[model samples]
Target: MIHSVLEFLTDELNTFIKLKVGDPTTTRIYLSGVTNEAGIAIPDQSLGISLINIEEERVNKDQQNRFVNAVGKVEKRNPEIRLNLYVLITANFQNKNPNNSSDDYVEGLKQLSYAISFFQSKNVFTPENSPGLGSFDPNLQKIVVELYSYSFEQLYNFWSVVGAKYLPSVLYKIKTISIQENAVLEQGEPIEQIFTQSQHKS
Candidate 1:
């Protein structure tokens, strides 16, 4: 499920870049990790989408999430596993020198700005919103993209943990990725009003 969502997003972003720069093959989006076939971080210019964190939607635990079966029977299941995906999109520019005339690294910042605008313009995505996906993932119903702000300390800590120098990057919180399995836990009877004693001692 995660793979499908990410793949869809990657394709959409690639399309966006192609349209913006008027060159379909200019840039590429990676699934994070600056690795090659041999698994090594190489300096390259492209967009990297990495999943930084995952959190279950505990607030929806009480809601009964379910799906209709083929036999026309509504099957009640446990609450759907709603997840918030903290995705980091990093622009890896080859040249890091700011003073150089031909610095792709600074170019990375420009690319990052482009991405920010793209998301700002289209913050919400659904199967209907994105027609280019063709046969969109069935499990993916909808997704909301939101910009995540971080403190200076948090930003420094992230790079430190990644064990790499800072790259022009932005973080987005992709919210409410729901995955529901049609597995019924238990059937429950309907609830009725309960009898209670009066506090005034009637």
Candidate 2:
């Protein structure tokens, strides 16, 4: 079930972002810092599945059902590939405080900082558990932390692209893109900077 959910989220994200499956360039999910004995880090992908474990949160029921349906579709279409999913957790404060008010905006930043710190403290990415690739550099990790910290708008854009009926495209994109530390940030600056630099580039 978890695998299906991860696959579904990957597909949806890719479709919205216009990336291809197994592209090794543009697709990836952000799992949260939760880990198991195998040290597998569960990010957004895992959280998405975890939500299904809840029986009470009906407000998000539609979203959850979409994800489940996505899993079945992905399995029928692409049975051979095992998609990667990332898990990312927002701090309790970020989840509770709506990001509309000025005070919430400031608090959101602080909460983001705390979330990053919590992930780092757990040594989320180390050489021993590099998904059997290689250990991620500490410098790279810091950059990833910074990018996710400063790029909420990009996150919004990415997810916004993942609306209804685009699940297959989204899965293809995730499989294709490489989930490196600075992939998103390296591709585009913080949302504010991108807007600022657009004037210069133009």
Candidate 3:
């Protein structure tokens, strides 16, 4: 299920965002297979809501090297445009206890909301001049914010419909949704370590 979602997202992003395979300006999005966890354990519930834990795959060493090389090429070609990539990980929880209970699903939605809020609050690209400023350039910020918001909203709606059909008592629990600046994993360094450190709030 999670795999299908990842593939779907990849396809959508690829089509929406202009990118060539080897272009540094291109954002490479990868998804990690679902985590092997039983489900979210809620108090008072005998059986927890069954969940499909989906995480973003850490950028591997090879990918980092390729990105570094790509950046170099992109810099030579177009130095003005600063390339940035973002990764978002979402976990979905659905009731599989046979009995219909919306509590767990509600909790999952709350978790997802919190995660989105957290991401929004920590957005470093926000401008100081305006309250709704999203990026350094006001015009660019407006476009980016609108595009991101619309894309995410569409995804959420699509997911809601899919969840309704597959798992009626569905709840989505999102963990860490992070954006790393100038991300490049050094050789021999573990990708996990890099992501872990980057995700940590200062």
Estimate the Cα RMSD of every predicted model relative to the unseen true structure: 5.4, 23.4, 20.6
Ranking of all candidate structures by their lDDT, best first: 1, 3, 2
Best by lDDT: 1
lDDT measured at residue 99 in model 2 versus the true structure, 0 to 100:
47
Native-structure RMSD, model 2: 23.4
**Compared with the true structure, what per-residue lDDT tens digits does model 1 show for residues 69-181?**
66655557877688889888888776656566435766678767778888899988876887644465766768788999998999999887777767778999988888876
For each candidate, give its TM-score against the true structure. Answer: 0.77, 0.23, 0.27
Segments of candidate 3 deviating more than 4 angstroms: 1-81, 84-91, 98-103, 125-147, 151-202
> Candidate 2 residues 1-202, lDDT tens each?
3343334333433333333223445423333333334433333211211121112222322221111232233111111222223333332222233544522435434434433343344323323433322222222211111112325574555445433111111111112112222111112222223333334554
Question: Of the candidates shown, which would achieve the greatest TM-score relative to the real structure?
Answer: 1
| TM-score for candidate 2, residues paired by index | 0.23
Candidate 2 residue runs with Cα over 4 Å from true position: 1-83, 88-103, 124-156, 162-202
* Model 1 weakest lDDT span, ten residues long: 34-43
Model 3 C-alpha lDDT per residue in residues 1-202, reported as the tens digit of each score: 2232234334333333223223445333224322234422232211122233334534331232233353333111111222222333343445545465533676445444443443354433223423433222233331121112235565566446434322222233332223234443342322334333346568
